[model samples]
Target: MSLEIKEQSEVSPFLSDAARSAAIDNKEKEIKDAQHENDDIMCGFWIFKGPLLQRFATETMYVTIYGVSGCFMAMCFAYFSGTITTLEKRYKIPTKTLGIISVGNDMTTMFGSALIGYYLRKVHRPRWMGIGLFTIVIFCLLNCSLHFIYGAGEDALKLTREFGDLQNITGNLTGSHKDQKLCMSEESTCMQENSIWGPQLILFGAQFILGIGQALFIVIGLAYMDDNTTKSKTPAMLSFSTFLRMLGPAVGYSLASVCLRWYIDPTTEPLIKPEDPRWLGAYWIGWLILAAITFLIACLMTLFPKELPSTRARRLKCEKDDIQNPMDQQMDLSLSGMWCSLKHLATNKVYVYNTFASILYFFGYMVYWIFTPKYIETQYQQSASMATMATGTVALGFSAGGVLLSGYIVSKYQPSARSMAAWNAIVDFLTVAGILCYVVIGCEGSDKLSSMAVTSADSCSASCHCEYVHYAPICSPNNDTYISACHAGCTDNTKDQLGRTLYTGCQCIAPSNSTSVPELQYAVDGPCHVDCFNQFLIFLAVMCFLKLVGASSKSTNLLIALRCIPPEEKSFALGVGSMVASLLGFIPSPIFYGWLIDKYCLVWGKTCSNKGNCWLYDTQALR
Candidate 1:
């Protein structure tokens, strides 16, 4: 029995060693298998036996879909901003009324309501985005005949010539001048009607459709990217997507700038040069083409597996994404679930703070985007093509570069929430300095012109009555350009041998800062400047650079909001934040900024037969 026990004990050690060896061999095999898997990913021999398309597409392809969607949306927004002035002129939309109309675009979120976000969370994201884009296409096509079908263009322009123009000039002028022009311009008791609803409604309705697409495309696409991809890659992917998105605006505005040079119908040569503020173009064509492209992108986005087929760890992460707030469990998928998640988001301090900063930043940006072109045109009297081109450069080159750079920096550092806040503050401070440049950088706008109510009040002729509403500007003999013959106080017009328009008997023709009163009584078409184009360009360059600096951030605003919320509420948090920003920033910015712009009006131009545009502005008073 003792001998048997001894043998058994001896065999136990050998058996234990054999078990250890097997474990070691199994581990080595696992290592080899992992290496093989990695090799398949990297090598050309990764022959897939699965579905053809699905085998080839990486996670980044999904990001590419988001990028394409954003790019097309950016194009639409750029088109809208670039052509707003032309639309205002064509539609006779007032600054205040236009603001109201802009607000109508954000009706989906109730101008920042969280309902859309909650709803999207429940629905299939790509499908919702697809449907929204499809609706956008339909509505945008509907707007094709907006000007032709609903227009009173000729009538509106004449009405302004007969009345609204006088009200604008007389209202700004002193009592005696006001009293004098009121009789010739219109009845003193006359009430100019608010916006006519037909054309305005068309714009509002089209924008509302666009707004839905915008909300769905931006929020859902962004969330889909985040949810499907690893956290480490999100910033880089987002940066790439945003870069493409910004490229859209650049391309759109560039095209619009070129198109604006020609008449609405390219075959029909423009009567007035592009320098004339009266120039309009085929604005509808841009929407038509872009809509087709966007629709295609939306369709392709659906091909990406609804939820990316994640590995074990990624699947676990996504399963958590399905969790509702308060407990990391499966979402209830009910009204109660949405409400609870939204409440949790609203109370998140980091989210709330980040939201405020974002909204403030958006406010400055929205104002800049909407008005920079207008400012360029009015401040420097640049042609629409030139102004839009410059604006596009900023949107494309500087702004896109800034966004990409910021995203790179964030990816490199992966900043904490506090650091992100600090970065935001610093960027905004720089932006303020850039914005303040508007107060001084611009030259005084054509003070020698008859439209300069401050400088040419006495020279303005009540006799011409400005009945044509034609912005055929003229240069006084002293070399200052007047907006038109009527502004030069000309009693009669004569055609030169070349058929160029001419004016005689100008009252505001005295030499400026001269020793003796010099009489230069006649004026002719085109502007006269004493060599300031170079200086104007310098201001624009400085403006672009500084604004670029001000606009860029070293951190991600989206990440800030996302990190502050529970994982389950990330999408809902973004929605609420966007709503808040639109409510406080985007919705009201145009209105208040437009009002500020209205303060600088020198001459108002009517659209057809209604109240129209301020054809001329006091550049110095623009701030």
Candidate 2:
């Protein structure tokens, strides 16, 4: 030790301590600069790479674009859902058929997400996201094209022409003739083979395209944002993005409500008003708007470089640090290694079990997400637009708040894994309870909607087939509801002072008061007022509470899955888990629920010999 100290002292006289320290600092700076240069060199060809444009390429900019893209995606889904009823009526598609159509997006995502997540890990993320957004734009355009391809719908007031012996005789039987919207004695015939399969397949294809875009949004966009942003700020950024996404449903539904108020053709007047059950709205207008917005987003996304400069430096530094204390071997992208990784993930009991739980959870919950608009409209006799707007606004608002509150609670409390699991279980139990409450909270169906096994005919209208009747319900003074004015056996009709069609000489209608003349018994032009406001209120309350409680546990399952796996494998685990959930849960939930809904269909509209869309539902079974 003495000999080493003497040698160091002799050498120290040749070089001052300050000069030596400066030399060491200079060497460290040069190494860091060299690493940064190498990192910059790794970026592939990109737009807006000039220094001026690069100055604006910040994480904040990326998050903004990412959030807006998410919002647009949510809007597309919400708009599709909000207009589902109109689509059903226009296309003569059964609920069950529509259910299967709804799953097309999930089917594609289930098969494609894992592959994309794994193979595209090192690609230019922003450019890929842009490409996905462009695909979505095409999806929107294709959906819009269906409206043009089919043209405006058939007129509801077009009279059914009866040939043979009864043509002239039956034509003069009623003041208002046997139009498509009224009760008639003639049997329905297939004018032409209305090949609904063409439209159905088109819609399914569009949704399938939508799934590809959504997969990119989930697998790439999120990872890119996380990689570029500071870890501590990520949660808040995500919450804000979620908040924006929640707003999308409200905006989308509201837009649908407005668009649906116009006639399907927009340029021409329609026989039926928006309130008429037979009305087909301008549902395609929303898609056009979305397509334009998505195109703009795609352009913006393309402007982003492969990686932000600061993030590149940070990533390089992290790689250097990781080399010193490696926790797991680097990933092998080979086919055998892929199989090995999948097997390893499958063997993780906690991840596997949590995935199963997620599948079940999504299975039960997706039904409501996909069908609540139809449910509200059917059960409460609410207009489609009103039901959609109301549900979207209230439900999404509460859900956003719940998610933010849960994030705050977790951040503040730093709960243990066991506590988080316990909380999730409690949330699940409450969600089940809420669902049960929904089962009992429904209102009675429309009186006119009551299904009769035999034709809806009595002695009053037995002679008038009533079998060919379209759903234009009438309400009598005595509150008796009839399928249509003709079904009520009304011999005459006149316009009231308020321009309302009032029917008299009705055999079916009873006088509200005995003092009224028998011949003066009258009926109105719409269904009897179903008092379901109170019940609807109760349903909304239960639904909001369920959303709040259920969303509170949204992150818990993912957290558990991540903690159970190695850090290097967490991303792969998420991809696999998503695939499993979509395959077992989302892909089939809507189809099954749609079939259940179809089972309660009381009056299936006729399209030739084939069963068309349901005109009326058995409310009791549906509830």
Candidate 3:
């Protein structure tokens, strides 16, 4: 020690103190930069490289374009859900058939994700996105073709001819026509039964295409975004992208609400007004518009590089073969590693158990979200548009808020796996409590309301001999709901100054006094009683709280699932977990619930031979 000190003392006079201090500061800064660069940032199931230190000029554009792409990915779901009832009504599809369509999506999502995830390591990302998006547009066009073909062309002729036998018939709702049959001839019914396969294929094929497209766009787009950005910015990019995606439901439902009021075939005149039960909307036009927007974005994104300038450092860390397209290179496609990971995941008690829990969570979620619009419309006697708008408001607003709030909590506390699980457990428990409110808080079914109940043929519409075809609602003097002006025995139909369709001289109105005729009665559209609005409000409030409690589960589930598994198995775990949830939850929940709903059909509308679709629900019978 003394010899080293003596040597340093002799050399000290040659060096300036200021120079020494500057050298020490430079060494310290280098150490700090090295430490920052070496840190790994955990985001969902992926870990990203950190702190590039230098800023790139093109990050803003990258973030904006990716976020919008995410928005496009989300558009289909929101629009489909908002307009499901409209599709059923227009195409004469039943709830069970619609559930079948949903199953197509769930089934493909699992398979598509598995395929896309494995091959994504070897494919050019933007190229895949473009191809996927184009397929989406094509299938969407095919799906839209239903409107032009089914109800307005040769297909319509078949339905018209099938129903032609019923044209001469009257008052089939009751056995008042007991002397004669009210349905079609046996020959017509037999042929009509086989014809439904075409429409079914069209619906299922379009859904299947959409499901594949969704899987490609979502999984590949996210992976591409992560690969091309610095860790410091990647989290923000993904979060904002997700946030924008949620906005799609709001926009979709709002747009669909307005468009649904228009005739499905723009060039043809609608047989009934928007408020009538028989009205069909322009559901296909929106897809064309979405396709156009997606095309523009997809083309623009093709110009984006595989990796950004900041990502070059990380790219160079891994060895690679020289190729014209980096993404086209071969990857580790062997099944052994994946199988080993799967086995490891299956044995990890927490991961397996939590995955099971997620199934129940998703099942409950699907039952509520997919059917809430129908529920609101049925319970409140609101129009389809109004119900969609109402549910969208709750879904878009409360769910987004819940996600942001949960993210904030995670950022602030940096909760460990155990802590996060505890929080989710508490939240889910409360969610169940909130879910119970639906049974207790709902408005009485339309059948229970004096003014809205379906009346028997003997009491009210027996003399009218109504065919039950026209659905222009009218209220009787007894404050009871009748199917239409025809059902009320109204001989005259006229429009008032405010453009309200009025039915007068309704014979179904019983006399209040001992007089032969009742004072001239008028029945307009919609519910006559305004008091039912309160029930809808109460229902919305309960739903709002339920949303607040459980919305974060979606993002949190991925977090816990990833945390519970080995680092190497995270991607596989997520893919497997998603598949399990879909199989147990998304694929079956709708169908199961649909079966239950079918049992409560008060009136089934005819569509050729087989049971067509439910026109009126027996709300009192619904569980």
Candidate 4:
């Protein structure tokens, strides 16, 4: 053993440097492979796998919560305004005053939209949503208090007194100097008492608040949803959100109608009367309940996560490194770009045609929804609550049809942007036909008997007293009746001539000869004259069809436009389109329509009268 150890020591020597270098190279390669594997794991779903479900759940909850809230807000706006319009008519306020109030609300909405956009860009979206919800609560509270603040009962009594006295006088004066003078005097008086600014001011303020809340809630909620969702799903999500929001108005109006029915006194012929304290209380209760709901929504908003996880530091870094910048190009904020786009829209034949067609289609569609309730009230003699319910139900049908048709069309046609343009034109043609039918029906008046009266022979005398008589029919509330006696005592210029006029008094009579002489009876009855309910139903169906077509086409066009652009430019394109549409579609249209309606009434020889109940048509001018 000692000899073997001595031999090994003599042969041993240090290793060559080349071998060591090879070993070091092998280790370095192994480390590089490990690093590549680690990178793959981080980039793949496995890195944050545990949190994935949680994140998705949060996003869905936020979307659903906000969607429901948005729907409630929309319903409140539509329901309250519709109810208020009925109240105005019942209270005998000028329609123009209501117009101004509505205009003010829309203006506030415009400003609110702009403000929300600015704040969304500058502040946290969650905070903005919370603030908007709080604002809605405040506005609803104010709306509830308006009935009391405006002395609704007192105001109703004043109007009732004036109109009641006018009705009595018109019923008594059939054909004489006093009748002519009274007619002229009543017309002047009605014109003088068009609107009291107090109630109008309150309404204007309430509407302004509502507008602010709606604009803020809608725009902010949408922006948040867009920020949270995948780009491909944005449009579908938006459509779903719209559908949900529409439900609010339908439900709200239904509830309001129920409340009105429950509280209203059927014993009173006209449900909303001067001395009916219940009217004010009912409205207040409804609004207060809505306000409480809005307040709860505000509280829920506070629980919304303070920041979106997608916008977190780690996620942003990951996205920046992995994906191309979504918004690389700066927005073109110059006047030249705007002018160019406008010129392109105006001069391009396809663009011009589509734009004009869209305008006309939307115009007809809006007119149907806006005026349908009024038509129902005038034509059917329905209560305000009933009219609201009818309108809401029709709107619900339209909404349901629209949603279903939208899905079918999108799947079936796979339409391109150009095809959307064509479809819009087609919808316009159809809408025009529907509108024509509606206008004809509206102008035709009612199919029911125009006037009905009854007089007893026992009520007449032998002195040739020539007493006139009138009675109220069950259906028509605004009808008037006139009676005169042609006898020896009934001289052309003598006070013995018993003549009488009946205007909504239900019953009026004058003394007449006992002999059942030829009593000239004038009765007007036809379907063409009193069928507004059928007209409204038809109008609603057509509006639904038109809106579905137009909305689907517009949505398809947007999708096509997005497809044409690179993914990075999609958001900008959508934003620009929305801004343009708001300016062109919504703002200009309402103003122009309002002006046109007012002008139409002025040009026509229409007057609001107590006997003829011409005020019904007078309010129609506002629509």
Query: Quick one: best lDDT, which candidate?
Result: 2
lDDT of 3 by residue, 1-623 (tens): 67445444544465688875565566667767665443322111123222332232155666676667767656666677777877776556788878888678778877777666654654556567766676667666776777657654322221232333353365342332221212111222211343566777888888888777777776666566655666445434555566666677667777667777766666655434554455566777777777778777776555554445555555555435332334434435678756665677788999988988888877876676677777776666777777778777556777667766766666556667787788778878898887777676655536454234355334565545444333334555556666556556565655679855566666665644567563465566433442457888888887777776676655555556645654334445656766777788888998988777877775555544556666667665563
Expressed as tens digits, the lDDT of each residue in 535-612 for candidate 4 is 666656665665555445545543454454444333333333334444555555555654554442211111233121
RMSD of each: 11.8, 8.5, 12.1, 13.5
Between 2 and 3, whose lDDT is larger?
2
Better of 2 and 3 by TM-score: 2
What lDDT tens digits, residue by residue, belong to model 2 across residues 398-493?
Answer: 887877787777666767778878898898899988888876776654533565311345666766555555656777876666777767767666
Using lDDT as the measure, name the better of candidate 1 and candidate 2.
2
- Ordering by TM-score: 2, 1, 3, 4
Pairs of colliding residues, candidate 2: none
Model 4 residue runs over 4 Å out of place are: 1-57, 112-115, 154-195, 262-283, 310-321, 327-364, 404-415, 419-422, 442-614, 618-623
Error of 1 at 373 (Å): 0.7
Error of 3 at 294 (Å): 2.0
Q: Candidate 4's error at 363, in angstroms? A: 4.4
What's each prediction's TM-score? 0.79, 0.84, 0.75, 0.62
Candidate 3: pairs in clash: none
